[model samples]
Target: MQGNKSEHTIQKEIQLALSKHKCSVFRTNVGKVKTIDHRWFDTGLPQGFPDLMGYRWVDNQIFFIEVKSQTGKSRPDQLIFHEFLQSHNVIHGIARNVKDALMIVDGGLCGFGYD
Candidate 1:
């Protein structure tokens, strides 16, 4: 199923599913933009920020998802960011399909217990 869809499509599907489940989701666009003066500025997020972010009310948890196509690979900065999230006990993952994304948001994987 993942082999055919673009990342954007998968992301939309995931967002819809999450919304149906009463979770708040958002898309993150990361890149640099050139100003009229020909100066480049980042989109303000740290490099490698996840493609989506949201909060799951049931668990009172926040999650992040990096959407990718079947043949897509994360860049080094993204890998670093994922590692950082893990170390900080943040909920995050790479999702190639809606199922993967839902799993991450549902805390089926990449979830840490809080006291």
Candidate 2:
């Protein structure tokens, strides 16, 4: 348990660092400030995806994450989608664990905390 906790903390740190770096470089390239937070999709199908979505401007790609501070707190639809992504070996997210979800985005495939 202690080991897991330590590892989680380390992961969190790396994620934060990478996110900050990515955001900084991204903003510079766009020549704009103020990163928009959270883009939602309203499927109007009883439930929807929203926790967060990022648009990779250069590549015209999208990345999604569900994001829950606690694993069990995830919405049903999110759970379903999560499983689907896993099974298909596709990329999607449980959103985030906090206001700032640390993830390294590369080639439309995101690394869960840089490793």
lDDT by residue (28-63, candidate 1, tens digit) is 989999999999988999999988999888877888
lDDT of the candidates, in the order given = 0.82, 0.42
Clashing pairs in 2: 65-95, 66-93, 66-94, 66-95, 67-94, 67-95, 67-96
TM-score of each: 0.87, 0.40
Please provide, for model 2 over 1-115, each residue's C-alpha lDDT reduced to its tens digit, 9 standing for 90 to 100. Answer: 3223342453354345435544311111111234467564443432434344455445545555544443335656556655655566554444234333443244344324211
The C-alpha stretches of model 1 lying farther than 4 A from their native spots are 111-115
For candidate 1, the per-residue lDDT at 105 reads: 73
